[model samples]
Target: MHSLNRLARIAAVLYLLIAVIGPFSIIYVPSTLVVAGDAAATTSNLAASTGLFQAGLVGYLIIFLAEIVLTVILFDLFKAVDHTLSMTAMAARLAMTIIHGLNLLSLFVVSLLASGAAYLSVFDPAQLDALVLLLFNAHDLGYTIGIVFLSLHVMVLGYLVYQSGFLPQVLGILLVLAGLGYVIDSAGLLFFDSYLTTPFYVAIPIAIAEVAFPLWLLIKGVKEEALPKAAPQPA
Candidate 1:
């Protein structure tokens, strides 16, 4: 296989792995653990499933590390379209990646709380429960902050692909809309109480763009004949 094709396929595989691993750990597992109004049950559930909680944390760490690799590969893939914009997009993704890496520490703390660590003996049971829930809340909101930068990365990536003359323009447009959808959802989720009360379906569009983009990269890659060439400047 050609170098570009190989890179695309490798990145695609990583993207797929992340998609599979990320939701189970970051969303589904936590959603199951953190009961809405029942702090006692939440604490009990986490304490009982110490292994599950630790697995989820490890899963998140894997996703964060994989994301850094994917970002670098994508930067190389798209830089030919516009060097400055490509770098900007990569930088935005790197920032978000680092933030999420730190955000996962919140889960790490929860594991310690759930484990009945000796050092935690200073805090009463009720306090520990409250602290765990608080950390969970903080982790969720910190994800929104990371989304702000990830949204920027997606928008610039969309623009770069659209200008590249290799991929379909519609994909680029959809990618941009995906980023916008995330911004709207994040803004509302953070700033407005109503958003929390409702389902965050605004992000559904992201699945569309994200899945399609990677599939295209893996299956179709760039049309070699259609790849853009640098234009000569007037003498």
Candidate 2:
């Protein structure tokens, strides 16, 4: 039981690390460097901030590696509740992580295009700029697809948490809502041309649920009394 609680805390720490590290690549770098509908300008920005762009790539890699470890820890923590469901959740999260890691290749292509290398000399500056923008858009689409898988993971993990008895039920409910929000937003991004133009309140549940869950894990760990007892060994 004590070991389980300790594992929960370790998971919490890793979750917190991901939360802190993710936004630098996902939010900060893009907003800092990408210009909407201006391919030349965006490429110029990338060239000017090569160090920052590289840092963003490193940040993404760190998050990807962390997610791999986190997936295993979570599966262990929840497997006693329902082994199959825990495995399902772990699988979904792993799928999302793989998608994200592969998606970085697009960004790497963008970086190479921005490098002004001799090998790229065949392409005109205008062509290179357009290619950079296209790769960036492709990366965005891939990220949305990854989010769909993450939604599945969150929803399944939420169900496990609700059934486990060792964790707070409210967190489980919030996670389900958050997962639903992710699904809705991902659908919008994939299907609707005007999705980004419209105002959306889906972020509220996502923010609250993600933030609260990790904080709870860090502070409360798990309820000792509610943990499942190990089966007795043969005498």
Candidate 3:
């Protein structure tokens, strides 16, 4: 059981890393590559640019798959905590997990559409219009839903971390910030069109903290000496 618990924790960490870092890095790299290239490039150069874009799309799909695995393993770890939280808190966490899983499926569909469009672009640009429309609309909607649920999930996670004593309060604070950043970014994209890009920067730190803190918790477990004991009160 101890080993199983440790494995679950490790899986959760890997999932978080792949899901957050993989997609972000992939997108940034290809975009940078394209921007740094010559403006007046040949068909081959364009093809290379497209190839970079395709790589990012593939990376997004990989991240989605990792997210699914991470969420499942985290759920298992939550069950292993051996601590009882409020019913509302438990429900919130479960809801967040379910919503995240749904978001992953939505992302997977978007990636498939993107991949199809990329392949079709090699033949004719006109062929990709419908796929592009479908992919963008789905992505926008998915982002909106994901941000809302993720915000709630992070808040719940903060509370859980506070109660667990196994995880640090600072980590919980970071989760809260990350959740708020998502909400702000999603809203900005939907409504403002132009706003501070701070959320994007905020996300990098949040992602790093998320992977680090959870892995630490899983490996070290709670500080046995620091854990508070449950007290019996009036019924």
List all candidate RMSDs to the true structure.
2.9, 2.9, 6.4
How accurate locally, in lDDT, is each candidate? 0.84, 0.90, 0.54
lDDT tens per residue, model 1, 99-185: 888988887888778877799999999899899888888999898899899999999999988888878998899899888987887
| Residue 170, candidate 3: C-alpha displacement in angstroms | 2.6
Q: 1-235, model 3: which lDDT tens digit per residue?
A: 4344465467656655675666563346334433222322222233445665556556666665665555455544444343333333345544544554565464345345445554555645433434444443454455466556656656566665656565677777777776677677767766785653546576775676666666665676555445444433224
Prediction-by-prediction clash tally: 0, 0, 0
Q: What's the C-alpha lDDT at position 228 in model 3? A: 43
- Looking at candidate 2, the ten consecutive residues that score lowest on lDDT are 226-235
Relative to the true structure, candidate 2 reaches a TM of 0.95
TM-score of every candidate relative to the true structure:
0.92, 0.95, 0.60
Where does model 3 exceed 4 Å of error? 2-8, 19-21, 24-26, 29-46, 80-141, 199-208, 218-221, 224-235
Identify the leading candidate in terms of lDDT.
Answer: 2
The model with the greater lDDT, 2 or 3, is 2
Worst 10 residues of 3 by lDDT: 35-44
